[model samples]
Target: MTLLTYRTQARWAVAVVNSKKATAEFYDVETNKRIPRTAWTADMKAFAAEKAANVPKPPFVFRLTIIGWIVVALLAAGFGVMTYETLKPTEQSAEQVAMEQTPVVGDMYFGRFEGAAEPDSLVAISDLGFGWFKIVKVEGDTYFVAKSTDMSKQHQPKEQLESAEFEEEGTPAKIVEQTGWQLTLEAIDESVTFYVTDKK
Candidate 1:
C-alpha cells in the first residue's frame, strides 16, 4: 500500500510506498480526505513513463545562482584581506632592528704621549648633542683620543678631555681610556652605526 499527502501551503508532498506490492494512493489537501488508489499495472506504468518524458528537466538557473554566490563570497573575503594588508602598517623587521641598533658617533683627538711625536688626539661623537671640532695638528705617527666636559669654544680639537694639559706645558689633553661609553641608533639615511663614546 502507498499513500501521498500534498500540503499546498507548505509546498510539500509526503509519500508512503510499498516497494514489494507496487501499489500507491493519492490524498486531498484538507480534512485528511482519501482520494483514490493508483495501481501500478502495465497501463499505468506506460502512462507514467509518457508523463515523465513530457516533463522538463530541472533548470540550470538554481545551480548557476549558487555557484555565482559562492564566487562572490570568495572574492569579497580576498578583497577584505588585501585591504587590511594595505591599510595596516607592518611591524619592524630584524634588519630594521639591526639598523636602529646603530648610533651616530661623533669624535675628536688632542694632546701628546711620551712615545708619540705629535700632540695626542682625542675623538668622540654622540647622538645626544650637536657639536664639531678638528685635529689642530699632528707631528708624530701614533694618536690617542680623550674626552672633556668643558671644551673651549675656539679650541681646534675641542675634545672633552679626561686629563688637562701635559706637564710639558704643550703635551695636550689625554683620554680616560677604559671609561669611554657608547650609544647606538638607526638614522633616516638607513645607516646603522654606533657612537663609540658617549657622555654619561
Candidate 2:
C-alpha cells in the first residue's frame, strides 16, 4: 500500500492506494466519501476548469500617485471657489436698486399739467424738446412754469404749481438737481405721476 495525495471538494487529503483494485480509490478527508480515481477524468477536469473560469476575481483598487492627488485637490479647490462666487450676494443696496429703476427729472413724460386741459401735452421739469411744458424753477415740492400755449415755450408762461410734499415709493431718487425743491416722484405702472404745489 502506498499513500497518495489529491484535492477533494475543499482541501487536499491523503489516501491509501491498494494496488489490488483495478482503479484507485480516493478517500475524502472532510466527508469521508471514497471516490474512484477515475472521477478525475477528462470531463471532470473540464468542469473544474469551467468553475475556476467563472469564479469572481477580487475588485480592482486604484492607487493615486502624488501628482494625481495634487491635481484632484486643485480641482476640488477650484470647484469650491466657483460655488462661493455663484452664491455670493450682490454689492448694490436696496436704495441703489430703486434709484436705478426711477426716471431722471429731465426725462420727458407724456402727460398734461392740471390747467393745461390737453391730454397730449408733453412736459418735463427742464426744457428737453422744443414743444413741451418746461418747469423753469422748482422750490421745495413746488414747480414753477407757465400755462400751455401754441408753442412749447408758451406752455409754461409764468404758471407755477406748488406743494409742500409729494408722494413717493421705494427709495426716493433725485430726478433733478437737488435744488431747494422737494421734487417728489412716484412711479405708477408704466407711467410716473408728478405733483407740484406753490412753494410754501
Candidate 3:
C-alpha cells in the first residue's frame, strides 16, 4: 500500500490511505492541511429524513376505494326500494273478494254503500239506473269527494244541505221518473269498496 504522510514542525504526523473509495477521511496532522477525522452523522440524518418523507399519509388511495364501495351500496339500496314499488300488485284484498261473492240485494247492482251494501232493495229492479230507461240511487258525487292520492290534502265530500242531489257532476246523464221510481246518473269514487266493483 502507498502511504501519503503529513508532518509539521511540532512533530505531529498523519497517514492517508485507501478509505472506501473517495469517502471523506480525517487525519491528526498539525500542518500540511488535511481534513480532520469525523463521523458521518449528516449522512445518517439525511437517510432518516428521506425514509420519513417516503411514508404514505392518511386519506390515501384506500380511502377513495372505501368511498366508492359506499356509493355502490347506496345505489343498490335505492334500486331495491323503487323496484319493489314498481312491481308490487295494487289490487283488492282477499277479504274484499270474499265479501263480494255473497249477494245482499237479490242480484241487483249496488255501486257502493260503505262497509257493505244495503240488505234490502230500495227500488224495483226494472227502475234502477243501471237498466235501460232506469235510474239507480247513489250516495254522493266525485266533484265534492275531493279525489287525491294523499288523504290529508283532500277528503271525499260528506254532507251538504243546500247542494243538489246528483251523480257525476253535469255529465248530461238524463234522469227519468216512471212507475213510482226515478232514474239518476250513477257514479263511482276511489275507495276500497269501489275498487271491488272494478275487479268484477
Candidate 4:
C-alpha cells in the first residue's frame, strides 16, 4: 500500500492506494473523514500528477555577486604579493650586512666588531658599531684601506691599516680570505651578525 498526501489551502488530502487489489481510499485532514475503498479515479490520479509536477526545482547553476568578485580579486592580489616577497631579492643595507657576516672587499658594510674596542687600531670592518664602511683598498695579507661613516659616537678613524689581523679570544672568528679580486666573505659568526652591499 502506498499513501500520497497533497496539501490544499488549509487541509491535506491523503490518497491511500492498495496496488495488488487495485483499490484506493481518500482521507481528508481537516474533517478527519475517509471515503470507502474503491477503484482509482482518473480525476484523482490526474490531480496527484499535477501536484507532483508543480514542485519547485533546484537552480541549474550557482551565481556569484559583485561582492564575491571583489573577494576573489583581493585573494588573487594577496597571493601575488606573497609570491613576489618569496621570490624577490632581500633588501640588505651596508651596515646590516657587516654586522652579521664577514667583510667583503669592493662591497661596503657597517657594524661593530669585538676585538677593535680601541680607536685607531687595525680593526676589521666587521667589528665596530652600527655604521657604514667600505674596504676601499686591499693589499695582500698585511694591509687594507676602509672608509668609515661613523653613525655612532667616537667613530673609528677612516684610514688604511698597514698590518690587519683577525681578533683573538672570545669566539673563534672565521674571516674570509680574499684570495682574488672577487671578495667572497662566507664567514659564519653566530655570535655577531652583519649585512653587506655593493655600494660604499
Candidate 5:
C-alpha cells in the first residue's frame, strides 16, 4: 500500500492505494467524503496544478539597516502628527464665532403680526400673508429692526430680501428698537406668531 496526496480548490485530498492494482481510496479533507474515481473531472488536475503553483511561500524575512529604521521612525512620527492635526479642533474667526452665537446685522426675522395692519394699507395680517424685519443697526445688546413691506398673500419673500442692497429701496415705514430682554418678551407675545431668523 502507498499513500499519495493531491489538492482541489477546497482542500488537500489523500489517497490510500494498492500499488500493484493501481486502485485507490480517495478521501477529501474539506468535505470529509470518500471521492469516487468516476466523479473526478478534468478540472481536478487543473486545480491541483494551480494549488501547487500558489503554495504560500515562507514569510519574507526583513533585516532593516540603521538608516531604514530611522526612516520608518520618522514616517511614524509624521503620521502621528498628521492624525492629531486632523482630529484637533479648528479655531473660528471672530466674525464667524459671533454669527453662530448671536444674530448678525444682516439677519432678518420673518413672522406675522396677528392683528397689525399693513403699513399704508388697511389690510390686516393674514395666515397667507407674512412679513419680515431686517436688522438695520446693532448697538451693544440693542437690535434696531426695520419692518419690511407687508409681503402680500405670499409667505415666501424673494432672495433679494437677503441682500443689504434691498434695504436701500425705500425708507422703512417702522423701526422697532428692542433690547435682548424685550426681544425675549416678544417671543411669548400672542400677537407675534413666529419669528424665524435668516442669517447672512
Candidate 6:
C-alpha cells in the first residue's frame, strides 16, 4: 500500500490516503492540532487566507512591542522626576536666610527698655544708646540708623513705623558697622534681643 498527502486552500487542512482506503484529517497549522472537518467553516477559511496575506511578520511585531515598552518606561521616568520635584522640600540657602534676617531700609527694630514706663519700647541698638530709631539706609556692613520720635507704647507701632510720614530726611545720627563676628558678639552682649517688626 502507498500513502499520499495533499494540501487544501484552507492552508491548515491536510489529506492523507492509503491504497486500501482513502481518509482525510484536517489540522490547524498555527497550533498543529487536529480539527474536525465539520468545524472548518467558510468564515474560518476566509480568516486564515486573510491572516496569511495581510499579517505583519513576527520580527516587525516584536520590534513594535519593544518600542511600546520603551515609550512606557520613558513616560514612567518622566513622571517620577516630576513627582520628586513637586514633593521634595524646598531649602533656603544660608545667604538667603541671612539676607532676610539682616536689616534693610524702612525696617523697624524693637527692643525692651529695662527701666522705662513701658517695658516693650521701640529702641535703637543697645550700644547706640536707648532711643527710638529706624534704619534709613544700608551700605555694605554699615547700617545708617536715624533717631525717630519716641514711641513708648507697650505694643509695637507697626502701622506708624511703616507709614511714609514716619520717615525723616536728615543725616543719620548713628552709623553701626560690624563684621559677621562682631555682630555675633554684639548679639551676645545685648541685654534685650532686637527683632525686626516691619520689612520694606
Q: Which numbered prediction scores highest in lDDT against the true structure? A: 5
lDDT (CA) per prediction:
0.35, 0.38, 0.31, 0.42, 0.46, 0.44
Error of 2 at 58 (Å): 4.9
lDDT of 1: 0.35
**Which segments of model 6 are wrong by more than 4 Å?**
1-87, 90-133, 160-193
What would the TM-score be for candidate 5 when compared with the true structure? Answer: 0.29
lDDT of 3 at 132: 10
lDDT of 4 by residue, 1-61 (tens): 3434433221113222222212234666666676444654777767656655664443322
Per-residue CA lDDT of candidate 2, range 1-200, in tens? 22133222311132222222122234567767765657576765565556545544423223455666677799999999999999998586554443344233333222233222234657534322122233444445444333223323333422342222222212222244222222333322313333322221
Task: Score residue 26 of candidate 5 by CA lDDT.
Answer: 48
What does the lDDT read for residue 49 in candidate 3?
Answer: 52
Query: What global local distance difference test value does model 2 have?
Result: 0.38
> How many angstroms is residue 21 displaced in model 6 relative to the true structure, after the best TM-score fit?
62
lDDT of 3 by residue, 36-150 (tens): 3344357644654554445444222222245566776899999999999999986756645533442221122223222223448563232111111112322232212211112
Two-way lDDT contest, 1 vs 5, winner? 5
lDDT of 1 by residue, 67-182 (tens): 56677789999999999999998786553443333221222323221222223445232213222222222334212222234433332332444333322212222222322232
The alpha-carbon RMSD values of the candidates against the true structure, listed in the order shown, are 17.1, 18.8, 23.0, 14.0, 14.4, 16.6
Q: Which scores greater on TM-score, model 2 or model 4?
A: 4
Better of 1 and 3 by lDDT: 1
Candidate 6 lDDT score relative to the true structure: 0.44
By lDDT, the candidates rank as 5, 6, 4, 2, 1, 3
- CA lDDT of 37 in candidate 2? 50
lDDT of 3 at 171: 21
